[model samples]
Target: MTLKGQHLELLPVDSPEYKKHINKFKDLHLINLYKIHYTGADKNNNSDDSWSDPIYFHGTGHCGCIDRHIERRTGSVRISVSEWCQHDDGCETRGILLQGHCREHSLHEGRHYFSEDIEVALKYAADGLQEHVASDNLSNKARFSLFLCKARNIHLGHEAMHRYVVSDYDIIPCYLVIVCRQL
Candidate 1:
C-alpha cells in the first residue's frame, strides 16, 4: 500500500531503507517540510506588513520630533551625497553600471564635491544614519555610523539603504560601498 522513496507510509522493518531511516532518526536529523499555497495574486490573498522595516536611526539632533545631527561631527573628514537622485530609465546609474564607475565624471556625475556640497551630503548622510539607527535592524545603523566616522575621501550618502564612498586609492578612482549588508 506504500511506494518507496516518495511516500509517508510505514515501511516493513525488514527492508534495507528501514536501517537508513532508523539511522537518520538516531542521529537526530530534523527535517521540515511545508506545502506553500501561493496564488499569483499573493497580495490580494494575504496582506502583511510585519517585516517591512529593516533599520533604525538614532543619535543627536535639533529637530522637535527627531534628532537633526549636523554633517561635521568634526572638522576633518568631508561627506557628500551621490550626484544623481532619480535613478530611473537612462539615469546615471546606467553609466556606473555599464562602465563599472562612471565613464565621464568622478563617480558622482563627474562633480568633485568641495565646499558647500560636502556639507549638504554630510547632512543627508547624518539624517540617513540616524534613520538607520531608529528603524528595524541594529547592525546596519552601527555599520553606517562606523563608515561615517572613518571616511577620508568623498562621502556618498545612502541610496537604497547603503552608503558609498570614493576610495583614497589613486589607481582605482571609484566608489565603494562603505556601509551595507553583505549581499
Candidate 2:
C-alpha cells in the first residue's frame, strides 16, 4: 500500500492512498503516446470499425486503418496520417491543407497527454508505480514480476498518473517518456 522511493513514495492500485496519489495530476491534459490498433472481432457485426488485425505504428500522425473491408483489397490501400486534429472538422492547419497536422494538434484528447505535462508526469509513473508494486507485491511474498520493462517500465517503473483518468489498460502511457529518459 505504501511505496518508498529515493525522494517520494506512491500507492499502487488496490490501495487506499492510490487514488490520492493519482489525483496530483488529475487536471493535466492527456495526449496520445502511440497509435496502437488492436484486431479480432466477434460474429455479431462487421462494420467498418471492426478490428481486423493489429497494426502497430510508431510515432503519431499515422492512423492504423487498412483497407480490409468486404469490397476493399487486402493490403493495397492506406489512409495517410492526418496531420491536424481531424477529430470533428478541426483539421484546418496551414492554408487549406498544405502543412498538414502539426504534432501539437494531432493527439487523441481521450488517450494521450498534452505536450506540456508529459515531462512532469513520467517520474510519477516510473517511480510511483514501480515502488508501489515493489513495496506491496514484492516485499510481502512470492512475486511474479520483480521488475517492469519497456513500456511496462513507466507503469511499473513508476506510475503514469492519468491512467486513473482514462481507467483503460489498453491506452498508451505518457510517451514523452520516450524523450523523458534523456531528462
Candidate 3:
C-alpha cells in the first residue's frame, strides 16, 4: 500500500471515458477513504481549535472536518478543512469539495460553479505525487510520507499559481482526495 519509489503516470481527467467512470461511481454512491496531507503553513488550516494536521474522510453522509497543525522547524501554523456537502444543486458532483468559501456571500450554485480550477490543480498535484510514488524506491512508510509531501507541495503550488483568480482567498498548503468507489 505504500507508494514509495513506484512509477505512476498522471492520467488525463478530461477524457470522455474517465468522465463516464466518475459518473458511474457517483451514481452508485460509493464511499472511499483517502489520506490528504498538507503542510501547516498557516494558523487557520483546521476548523477545530486543536491545531492538528488536517485529514479528511469522503463518502456518502460524511461530514468533513478541518484540522490544523504546526511545523516544528518553521514555527509556522496552517489549517485545512473538508468540503461540505450541501443539499443545494451545487452538491451534485463535487462531493465534499474543499476550497475557500465566500464568507460574506452565500452563492448556492452548483459545485461546478465553485472552484473548478482548484480541483484541476489538485488533480495535477495528485498526479505528480502518484508519479513520484510509482518511480521512487523507498520503504512503504517512507514512500507514503513522500507521496503525501509531494501532494501537499503540488496543492500549495497550485494555490499560489492562482491566487489572483479567486476572491477572499487565504491560500493554505493542503491536499485533496477524490476516491473512486471501485478502488
lDDT of each: 0.26, 0.23, 0.26
- From the highest lDDT down, the ranking of the candidates is 3, 1, 2
Supply the TM-score for candidate 2: 0.19
lDDT by residue for model 3 over 58-147, one digit each (tens)? 111111111111011132222222322333433311222332223332232211111223333333333433443453532222211111
Error of 2 at 137 (Å): 21
lDDT of 3 at 23: 42
TM-scores for the candidates = 0.17, 0.19, 0.21
Q: Root-mean-square deviation of each candidate, in angstroms?
A: 23.5, 21.2, 18.4
Q: How many clashing pairs per prediction, in order?
A: 16, 16, 22
Q: What TM-score should be assigned to candidate 1?
A: 0.17
Tens-digit lDDT track of model 2 for 1-183: 111111111122444533432333333322111211112212212243432222211122111111011132233232232322233343121111222112334334433221223334343333333433444532222111111111211122125332211212222211110111211
Off by over 4 Å in 3: 1-119, 135-169, 173-178
How do the residues 1-183 of candidate 1 rate in per-residue lDDT, one tens digit apiece?
111111112233444534433332221221211111112222222233331121111111111111122212332222222211223333322232223232244535543222122233334434545543454543432322110111223344444332333432201111211122222
Better of 2 and 3 by lDDT: 3
Best by TM-score: 3
The deviation in Å at residue 179 for candidate 1 is: 2.3
